[model samples]
Target: MNRLPYATVARCVSSLSRTGLYQGVDLRVLEAFDLDALAHFSGMQPGALCAGACVASQSSPALALTSANLRWCPACMAEGLHAALFQFSPITRCPTHNAPLIQACPHCGKTIPYRLDPAAVATPLACPTCMSPLVADLTILAHAHHIVGP
Candidate 1:
């Protein structure tokens, strides 16, 4: 991945500096993919995929939805894929596999961090605390659905 230019960093810093609320904000936060910013920076029009934030923002009296730390579908991980929906707190199960999404390492019982260091051996597919591969357990899936009602 190409590092962001100094000018981009300076611009972001300058903007944040004016706000005075977020002092010492890490520059790495800027590298996180933002659909709106990406569209503006690339000079390409954002499409339907860009509506995620809007959809997430809409309120409903019946459903109390909130964003959570990164969670993963182990089956998806085994297939080398990550679904964006798993990051939502209200989504407790993987739609594709009918398996429960895991937020913490089964071994270490620590919540997964939002971002993983690229240089670290601990990947999104593995537990940062125990370095154990995150995989789906069918037994747990059976128990989960029985309690939660699938």
Candidate 2:
């Protein structure tokens, strides 16, 4: 994968990297990319996708995010989604699905950190260790399009 300016550019809600010691996306850098490009790559609206996260807009908090580990919502994952707010240190719950954010995989009980390489992002919504799904079927994911909606 191309090395983005700051780091891995997690497209929508469900993908990250495979290798090279890089981690999560830096929104300031990502904001530079065309929203159409991002949506074309990830099948989501860039603004709606990141609505839960803090970013570089003068009105928003300045990059107050936690990217070292993967903390997510199972209910949202069940529908094949991950919210950017999960990366916010202050957010311990999923306001959309009303589920607590979790760091460990339910299948293998392993903590899956964000990765941004080809292989990992290729199977973005799966557990790297157990090869189990981090989200439910991708088909189900389509039905949950309202996930990032206002």
Model 2 Cα lDDT, one tens digit per residue, 3-84: 1211234443233333322443443323434556555655567676455444644244555445546778888777555666
Model 1, range 15-118, lDDT digits (tens) per residue? Answer: 34433422233212332245455455534455633432213222433223434355778777664556656765788999999999888877888876643233
Candidate 1 is scored at a TM of 0.48
lDDT of 1 at 100: 96
Best by the TM-score measure: 2
Poorest stretch of ten by lDDT in candidate 2: 1-10
* Per-candidate TM-score against the hidden true structure: 0.48, 0.58
Q: In model 2, which regions exceed 4 Å deviation?
A: 1-36, 39-64, 142-150
